[model samples]
Target: MNTATHPSESHEKLWDLIKDIKFGMLTHRHATGMMHSCPLTTQNKKLDEDSQLYFFISRKSELASALAADANVNVSYADPGKDSYVSVSGVAAIREDQAKKQALWSAPAKAWFAGGVDDPDLALLAISIDHAEYWDVKESKMVQLAKMAAAAFTGKQPRMGEHKELNLS
Candidate 1:
């Protein structure tokens, strides 16, 4: 396990693990208490100091309606090739800031919002991160498999990577 001497260090580690990830599986509770998940592209080019994540969603989407009813959410990122995974839990809300939308706006997002940044149906979803946990494995797949085999022979659990949890709130 990797230990962070400071909260900022932990924050940086969390961002490093997820920044290159293309899509995050966002999960939220539905009105019927069922959990729903949808893949959303992370819009942040940089990790904010406050650890907020941004995504663009249609104002009419189920996610948008779910957040309006219940704000708690979790976003999960995985890069199996790199053996890295991150899970972030937070409160979600719709942001009405046009400047923020413009700042995070990109060409690819235009695919979803045909009217570009001025799309009325486009809503900026902000997740105010409260807690995050990550697992990052430094070893290659072959080496990790060997370690797992060794542990299996010894009847012990394999220590494959660094796992840490951070409370950003």
Candidate 2:
């Protein structure tokens, strides 16, 4: 629980892990007060200076409505191959910025938003990250397993992965 406080290098480490993990699962509270989650594609290949993350979503979608009703949300990303995971808590607000949409738009998005940036339903979901936590282990699975076995044989605890918690606000 040493990482329960603010982390010094968490921001940079989080960016490195998430930059290549293009997809994240966004969770929000529904009108009925139930928690819902869905996978979303990130607008940024990396995070902004202020630690904000963006996603393109449909204005008419359930997530958009959820965001309008309650801004608090959580986004999670996982890079299993790299033994990295990130959880970001933030407040989401919808933005109708065609310029930003244009900048972030790609051929992959065309599959959903047929009219591209000009689509009426197209909107940007801006997440102003307030806090984040990450688990980043550089060791491979086999190495971890070997260490665990050695620790068991020696009657010691296995060393776990690195975990950092940050206050982004």
Candidate 3:
């Protein structure tokens, strides 16, 4: 069976897989020289035909503070049941536009801000992705079984194929 897919096809497939999985891990570097990663709910906007960006967080968050100090950030997502994952590297900025806030707001978001649309603590974090790499197992259980069998038979290591990398800059 053919295992390789066209680069664009792989990129789209991975994006579709995780696009609806609302939560992702956002990583940022603090001034104290420590890297912090936290779970965040994200909303996406199609920046262009091929590229997409995410908006998240409130201004008062530690994660937002870290992003303000340093725009460089990384985000990761995965669906364990499907054995698919993505790691994205990007830059982030705090957006304070009222129109933008209104555009992205929803009933669920209101729970995060007590003051509603005019909440002073509300802040939009925009992530401009530079690149993303994804791993998708075509036959997850079968692959695990193959690995176990190989290790049991010859004491040899099993290797999965390379991840598909997409540059969306």
Candidate models: Cα lDDT each: 0.91, 0.85, 0.73
For candidate 1, lDDT tens digit of each residue in 70-146?
Answer: 99999999999999999999999999999999999999999999999999999999999988888989998899999
Q: Write the per-residue lDDT of candidate 3 for residues 1-169, one digit (tens) a residue.
A: 1233455664565567677777889888987979988887776543334454556577777777777789998889988877788888888888667887787777787878888778898877777777778776766688789887988898887656446676666
CA deviation > 4 Å runs, candidate 1: 1-5
Report clash pairs, candidate 2: none
Q: After superposition, how far is residue 92 of candidate 3 from its true place, in Å?
A: 0.5
For model 3, the superposed segments whose C-alpha errors exceed 4 Å read 1-11, 45-52, 151-162
Per-residue lDDT, model 2, residue 17, is: 76
Report each candidate's C-alpha RMSD, comma-separated, in the order given: 1.4, 2.4, 3.6
Please say which candidate is ahead in lDDT: 1 or 3.
Answer: 1
Residue-by-residue lDDT tens digits, candidate 2, 80-149: 8888898999999987777878888899999999998898988889999988888888888999999999
The RMSD (Cα, Å) of candidate 2 is 2.4
- Candidate 2, position 166, lDDT: 76
